[model samples]
Target: MDTIIKFRFLGDGDCPDWLLAEINTLSRMTSIKIKILGQTVVKYLTEGDLDEEKVRKITQDAKVELNDAKAMVAALELIFTSSARYAVSAADLSSELQQLGLPREHSAAIARLHTDHCPQITATLSSQSLRVSRLSSIEVLSCDNSSPFSTVSLKLKRLDGNVENSVINISKKDVHVLLTELRRAKSLMETL
Candidate 1:
């Protein structure tokens, strides 16, 4: 049996309790296996070989811009590790992928995650706030487009599961500082 990696899935609303229970039951029966990968994440691997040829065809048809399969895997690894909530928002994921400077079409392939793809990936993005200690949502309120330097007003919902959000109206300079501090804080947290 081939091994499949269960990156990390925190206890989340992505899957309903009943469904999760059923998966657990099946796992216990040895029909499948659930491997806990970390304190807050679990990897679900199944015994089998994936249809790489099919994946290739899909990748080609989708015109994915990743330089190679490893690049795609690396991107996914960063994205999966970037947060503790066991999920990454499409918008946030886009920032990481867009750094590659792929064309819109190719980028779209990477950013194709929508509410339709999986409920876990999107959460209750329409109304839920996640209540988890990570980025739950982001809403762009306004962007001033005057010159090379532009200001943006953003409403970032860091809370999870339908709670009131934190709104910030900030300039580009402030965004840089905030991002720096955020990265530093993230680094500190990872050390723990």
Candidate 2:
């Protein structure tokens, strides 16, 4: 017999009793209101803040507590961000939310929004990632008989919009290994 594991859209501690109760009110809200909430969640993902007016409108329409509305907003952010990070499909996200006690209609609406804005969400997150400069160019200098190493020059573009040059010397065997790894990386990238 095979056991199936379901994907969780939110963390274990993410969904509280209050949030679960809040989600039950989703059925009372109009589809347009639900869509607005979903869009607000996506906007927050990209901009890092929720529209207070929209939140107030949603809270008024849903007849739920203001804190509950805020919690719902926070939950939506967590769900979509986790989904985007894990590359979860929209259908799967809906199913996961449903399993978490979200109303089917609201879950579907949120999932559709996830599908529509996933690319932008992913791009925004990747742009915010911490990393070193990106390699812009590479140059190999001629090896002379006086040395048993090759000199390589690399040009990197920093995140701060500055270009930095780097030079390194490598042994012949290391150069061969580096070339092999670089070729392998190119091959893998082409497959993608």
Candidate 3:
């Protein structure tokens, strides 16, 4: 349950090639967006500096839509993390899990839970010592010392039934929360 904040710069595909390649590359990745005066914004990519005043002024001067710019930054951040194994899209996650020889049933369960029941997914993964969850609207996969480190959480939606899912290490606190939530959900389901 340790809160970790990570950021990444956007890439080149989403923005115009010219104008400013730095900005373009920096705007294409998935990142966390913070709102200022009802406008979503992000820290500067160059140095991880959070200067709202400067960012606002620059956006106003450049005529860039603040929300759009922030979206790009968020996307870039996601991509960067995905590339680094800290996070991944559903497809990438499945591939990684397959490589690790996880079972198809588990992968399917994970994908369904991740896409349709995120809280449950987080809880279930945490129960299995997998530190994978949705944070700030993006999926994050991580590991730490308290659990066995050779695990990965696969996206269930992408499984072909021929591959196995991966395992990951998660914290006890996270597992506890997940278990509690799962029990609550199960109780609710039983009532229904």
lDDT of candidates 1 onward, in order: 0.38, 0.72, 0.37
- Which is superior by TM-score, 1 or 2? 2
* TM-score, every prediction: 0.26, 0.61, 0.22
List, residue by residue over 1-192, the lDDT tens digit for candidate 3.
Answer: 964322211221222233234334333322211123112222232234556665555555556577755553453334333333333344544343333333444334333322443333334334555433322111224334445432335332221234334454556556546547645754554443
Question: Which scores higher on TM-score, 2 or 3?
Answer: 2
Q: How far is each candidate from the true structure, as Cα RMSD in Å?
A: 20.7, 5.4, 22.4
Give the range where candidate 3 is weakest over 10 consecutive residues by summed lDDT.
32-41
Look at candidate 1 and tell me the lDDT of residue 104: 42
Model 3, stretches more than 4 Å misplaced?
A: 1-51, 86-192
Q: Which predicted model would earn the best TM-score?
A: 2
Model 2 clash pairs? none
Q: Could you arrange the candidates by lDDT from highest to lowest? A: 2, 1, 3
Residue range 98-174, candidate 1, lDDT tens digits: 43333343333333432124344233232244333554555556667565555666665543555344445566666
Order the candidates by TM-score, highest first — what do you get? 2, 1, 3
lDDT of 2 by residue, 64-134 (tens): 78877777777667677878887888888888778766778788898899999999998888877744444
Error of 3 at 155 (Å): 35
